[model samples]
Target: MWYVIQTQTGGEEELVGLIGKIISKEYYEECFCMNRECVRKTEKGQEIFLRPLFPAYIFVVTDHPKRLFLQLKRVPRLTRLLSDQEDSFFSVSEEEQIFLENVQNEEHIVQRSLVEVDDEGMIVKAYGPVGRYRNAIVRQRLRKRYVCIEQDFWGKKRKIYLGIRLREDGKG
Candidate 1:
């Protein structure tokens, strides 16, 4: 089962570091604080930096969400588990889970999608993380800066926004 934990927005990295001490690695397969590279234009210049995909939320994939939750509930900076009315354990919709799984590669880095646009500036297709779901793209940001995709998680449909860079000339 997987569970979502709400932690300090800018402190996820530190929270992970703190949790790493008392918990056993066997308790979970992943502790994901997903981030991706983003470019924003400033008066000075275009700045490139990593932005958290799911801010303040850490997703844990484990066979034992309850165990993991209980083990870390009181840990510093971790707020609460995203729970439902019934169970202490809550899982993301399957669709969302699938998307999350696909978002990250082996090193747990979310792929930075590269989009191809025709001379008319329309999105021809997307490469990288969204390569397989080109047709599923809901909105390709103006100038192909990002893409909004629809996904279903735990049966709820969601719109996910991902950053993309336009492909350079002569690049595949």
Candidate 2:
């Protein structure tokens, strides 16, 4: 099962590293934070960069949640494991996990998708993770090069923006 850990917004990477060192490998299968690819305009040209998909949250795959929780205390960072009102750790739903797994590659990065648009700027086709959820898109920002989709993540609604490379249909 996948569990979430909330920590300081800018300290996710450092905390993940600390948790890895403090916790035994037997307790958890994997620990990581998801990232999304973005295009940034630079003095030379457009550059691609990776940004955190879910800031302040880290996901862990573990069967032994109790052991992992206890071991996590040894890490110096301020962290909290997400849990229900009853205090039981909340695990990612199967549907949510599937969506995440599909969008992210082996490195856990959501790569920029390629989308084809018509002359009127209507999306004709999309290729990549964005394509899978094209119908669910809530907003499209072509100039900024991203499309936003809202999803229920662990009971909370979150709007996620995925980067895109647009091409005119039949032009490229």
Candidate 3:
């Protein structure tokens, strides 16, 4: 199932990186980390490091949120799950999971990125412009649904959008 955890502000990259290491191979059947790479030039750079498009948030997959929560509690930087109560936790929808799967299966170019599939089997990718722009973004020409990333334009910072493009596929 899917779950949301509170990440320390500006600590999304560290959290997601930790999620990859903590969730093990035996648990591979039970959990996974949803990581997408965004390539941007650094100040002195002529290279690229795969950075998370979603900075302060990450999606992880596990069979039991309770078990996962306890393990995560010990992690130095993690705060809590995104819920009304401090301890209460939640899972993501199955539909969201499927969408993420499709994106991860797509391609990846340097400037472009792909929403990767983490073990939990959820679409945890920062959906909107950035997501859709990833070379790996999925496209179902027949359905006319663009499962890409794009900015929704709601947050104070610039919103990133990712999804498929129906119009571009000549479906419209």
Candidate 4:
């Protein structure tokens, strides 16, 4: 089962990590992961760096929803788990959970470029999350010219870095 646990602003990943540890201590055969971007300082000064494919959220897999909730409630920084009736827990689709996991575990390239796909199926270097659900390339900075994009699945968007593979026409 999957549940959306609401956490305090900017503490989503931390709360998720805490949940993972607590579950492990209890010997619960469950797993949890939060999609977060890692930012670092380089010769180019400070960069916004990577964006968590899915920020402010974490996907957890478990069988005992009640027990999970009970355990999760004690975790600090977590506001509450999103439920349907404020009592009934909400579960996420397996496919969606897996997708989140993949993004959390994959390696991506960091380019000063963004991915742009137009109505003509043309992919170009554009700026910002412009398309529906902010999937389009977002121009973050103009001076250093840094572009970042997170992969989008319909209405849901996740942080995804630029790909290294160039298109046949030298575009990505």
* The best candidate in terms of lDDT: 2
Q: Model 3 off-target regions past 4 Å? A: 16-49, 106-159, 162-172
Q: Put down candidate 4 lDDT per residue, 17-131, tens digits, no spaces.
A: 6776655545245444443333355798544454444456555556776777777767665456667675577777666555544433433212333434455544454432222
What is the Cα-based TM-score of model 2?
0.94
Per-model TM-score, in order, reads 0.81, 0.94, 0.48, 0.53
| Global lDDT of each candidate | 0.72, 0.88, 0.46, 0.49
Error of 2 at 141 (Å): 0.8
lDDT for model 4, please.
0.49
Write out the backbone clash pairs for model 2: none
Clashes of each: 5, 0, 35, 10
What tens-digit string does per-residue lDDT give for candidate 1 at 48-85?
A: 67767777877777888777777786576646777876
| Candidate with the larger TM-score of 1 and 4 | 1
RMSD of each: 2.8, 2.1, 11.5, 6.9
Model 2 Cα lDDT, one tens digit per residue, 1-172: 9999999997888888998888889999999989999987789967889888999999999998878888888989898889875459989999999999989999899998899878877777998989998987999887788899888898988999999887731223
- In candidate 4 the C-alpha lDDT for residue 125 amounts to 43
Report the lDDT of model 2 for residue 13.
Answer: 83
Please list the residue runs of candidate 4 whose C-alpha ends up more than 4 Å from where it truly belongs after superposition.
21-33, 36-48, 101-121, 124-172
For residues 26-95, write the lDDT of model 3, one tens digit per residue: 3323332344433233587323344444456556566666666667666677456555565566655565
